[model samples]
Target: MNPNDRSIVALVMTGHGLVHTYELSIPIFMTAWLGELGVSEAALGAVVGAGYFLFGAGALPGGVLVDRFGSRRLIAGCFVGMGGAFVLLGLLPGLWGLGAALLAWGAAASVYHPAGLALISTGVQQRGRALAYHGIAGNVGIAGGPLATALLLLAFDWPTVAVLLGLPALLAAVGAWRTSFDERAAVGVHDAPDAGHGEPSPRPDDRAALWTRSKALFASGFAGVFVLVALSGLYYRGMLTFLPDLLTPLVTVDLPIDVAAGRYVYAGLLAVGIAGQYVGGRLSDHARTEWALAGALAVLAAVAVVFLPVAGVGTAALLAVSAVLGFFLFLVQPLYQATVAEYTPPEARGLSYGYTYLAIFGVGAAGAAGAGGLLQIAGPPLLFGALAGLALLGASLSGGLAVRRARVGTHP
Candidate 1:
């Protein structure tokens, strides 16, 4: 890549890492919040679910903003807003206050995927490689965030930990603000004649244009991909929300030193996803993304089915299974992201990612509620079974997509 591309990728990757660091770190605090705030599991789930809902539901608007305002501005704003929200979270005194902070955080976070992915899809030369690196950065954040939060909890209170966690984002915000890059130059779309002329282009009204795009996308089988993404999100969010809590009792590690076994195990599980993301991203560039997605979903289904049984075996077995599960879980992300790019036009990539994330994080927010409910009533077996079912559903949809693509002789 050129120096300019490298700079943009680095900046975006840094932002991506911080976004997820804040996101995944929240789960580590759930147990602490239960005791400190004196809330039921269901209520806590509802609160987190609300933030997650906005994280997704807000993406459409966020995408529009990205398309209008430019990706760099939105990404920089996300850093500031997310950091400020975390600072507020540290100072908040009640459940309602925490909820408000999370709401702010979610709103800020909602802008990231659309902006970042749009920047990458438009700016980067080797889209798949850039996406793989991007996924690796995010997985690093996922792996480190909870682990760091857990380790911090051992020394400082959750509030102080939240404050500390907000620091990196603030710094990233500064970095992003100072970094210079031309989105039009990187994407090369603005170089066309009349690109920046003060004359209006021969396009429909904004709403009409969006509607037309949406209809076209739906008619062209993007709807099926959207369904596959939503199901994947359901499985991803549902299984991950309470993975530490679920695995705590089942894992029996005999470490010599004092440590939060469950938290570390969770970290280890997510860390393995770095490899998964790399593999998935590379494979998406070479093979059919739908087929790759189907394979990953199949692995996820098998992992979900065997998760509980493996947990019963021993700590080693449980950790191994968790690692595998985490790998397949995150492996789907880059594949689906690449698939979305394949299915959309460069000019509308922001909007496409906006809808994609809405499915992934918005509808996917229900997974947390579903997991909490299942845990409350049916237990781990049913929860894992439900996850397995979701994965199977995704795999079936992906298989169907593959068939459809074959018949149409189109990559999307």
Candidate 2:
């Protein structure tokens, strides 16, 4: 790819990083936020759920807009909108205010996937690597969100933390507006114009469009892949959402170890996710995506096993297991995302990406809520066990895709 292409990907990916860093703070600092608002766990889940619902709802429309115009404009708009939402979130007074701000942020966040993925498909020769970079950048942003909030909460309040987080999004938004992506190269190679609206109206075959997508998905082994991706999203988000609570027990150990030790220990586990992101990216290039996903899930399985069996394990073992789980858990994200790209048609790639995110965040948000309920009912063993079972299901789903691909004699 040309320098311009690299520049575009870097900018878009960085914008995504900023958005996640700012917008995802609530979940990262949920304990503090809930304390400040005096809300129940279930209520917190509902608020977060509303954010995710809007996030998914906006995607399909975002896809249509990206396809109609181009990824560049949509990305620029998304960044600015997200930045505004963060600022609003910071300024919000209570639960109602927070919910409104998150809804706005989620709507803005929706634009990124379709626009960014469309840009990747348009600009890069090695689409998988490009997506991996983007995914890793977002992971870095995710890790940063919590770390930043944790540090800020030590000195300032959640409101102050929210305001500070908005700064990155504001700056990134400005940078996005100034940058120009290679639109011609970025998309339009294979994307079909919407016959419903675009000029020189083509044959309107909504039924054919549906069938075409279905056939492509089946031919590409995406039907089974979707189950794995969906299950992976469920387990991944569920684990991450409650990670702090899970670490609470570990941190509260009555040992005379340092007070700061627990905080650092927990942060260290999350920081290790960076390695997982890199490993997953590289592994996807060499191994078939299914195998790569399976490998990651296998690691998650082992982590769950070690974590569940070892009672009162020391900080070292906790850190080790947490890091290992973080590694494998996050590693699967990019690979699964790349599979979505590989499976989609060029014309509807934006829509395909939108649908993928819809499935991920939409379904995953529900999973997060369900996880809290599961924890309430059965406790951590059942919670982690259920997570493990989901990962295993994802592995089996991927295996089915492999079998289907063998029968079809090729992978799309």
Candidate 3:
């Protein structure tokens, strides 16, 4: 790859890492908030769910903004907003304040996926490899964020840790502002027709154009992919939201050394996703993305079905099972991302990603509340079973999409 490609990948990966760092760290803080604020787990989950809902909800508009303004501008703004929100989180001193801070952070963080992934799809040459590297960076943040937050909790309080965590966003904002890239080259369109150069330009009608594009996308069978992603989102959020709490009871063996056992195990499980992302990304490049997605979801369904019983055996067995679960959990990400790109036109890539994330994150945010409710009422077995069902549903949708694509003999 060229130097420009490398730079683009690096910038997008950095933003991806920062976004997940803030996102995944929230769960670690949730445990602290429960004790300090004296709130029920359900109440705390509601607050977190609100933030996640905003995160997903904002993505479609954020994509529109990225398409209009350019990805670099939106990404830089995201970092600034996220950083400021975290600073407020540190300074504020009440549950209400915390809720406000999280809401603000979610709004800010929502821009990253649409902007970063759109940037990658447009700017990079080795799209698959770039996406693989991007997934790796995200998994790194997923694993490291919790581990770092857990270690920080051992020393400093949650507020102080939050303040420290906000620092990277500040740094990343500066990096984004200073870095230069050609948006026209990436998207293969000029922002405006060159009036000075006597170029013929059509009168702009933003709303009509956006609606027309969206209508075409849905009519072209993007709806099936959207449903598949939504199901994936539901399963992803439902299983992950309570994983740490779920695992707490299953660990029966003592560690060789003293550690925050739940946190350590949580981090280890997510760390394994890095390898999964690498494999998934690689496969998406070489194999059919829909087929890859269908296969991954099938395995994920099987894993979720067996998770409860295997988790009961012993610490080693539980950890091993958790590792397998983690592998399939993240492996579907790149496949779906690549599939979205395949199904959409180049000009509308940003908007396509916007709707994709809306399904994955916005509609998917219900998983947190749903999982929390199940844990409180039905318990782990039912929860795992529900997740397995969701995965199967997602796999069925993906398989249908694959069949449709084969029948049409074109990318859908």
Candidate 1: lDDT of 84? 91
For candidate 1, the TM-score is 0.88
Scanning candidate 1 in windows of ten residues, the lowest lDDT window is 193-202
Quote each prediction's TM-score: 0.88, 0.81, 0.86
For residues 226-313, could you state the per-residue lDDT of candidate 1 as single tens digits? 8989999999889888877676677686777554467777878888887787788688889989899999999999999988888899
Clashing pairs in 2: 122-186, 191-347, 192-347
Give the poorly placed runs of model 1, Cα more than 4 Å off. Answer: 1-7, 119-133, 179-183, 187-205, 255-259, 341-350
| Predicted candidate 3 versus true structure: per-residue lDDT over 1-412, tens digit per residue | 7777788888888888888888888877776776688876566667777788889999777766776887899999999989888888998888788889989999999988778866776676566677768866877789898889888888888899999989889888999899987643444433432211011112124878878878877886677888889999999888877777667668897767554466667778888887887788789879988988999999999999988788888888899999998888888887887888778665565566668778888888889888877776777888898999999999888988899899989856
Comparing 2 with 3 on TM-score, the higher-scoring candidate is 3
Native-to-model Cα distance after best TM-score fit, residue 93 in candidate 2, in Å: 3.0
Worst 10 residues of 2 by lDDT: 195-204
lDDT to native, each model = 0.80, 0.67, 0.79
Distance from true position, residue 242, model 3, in Å? 1.8
Top model by lDDT, which number? 1
Error of 1 at 142 (Å): 2.1
Per TM-score, the best of the predicted structures is 1
lDDT of 3 at 239: 80
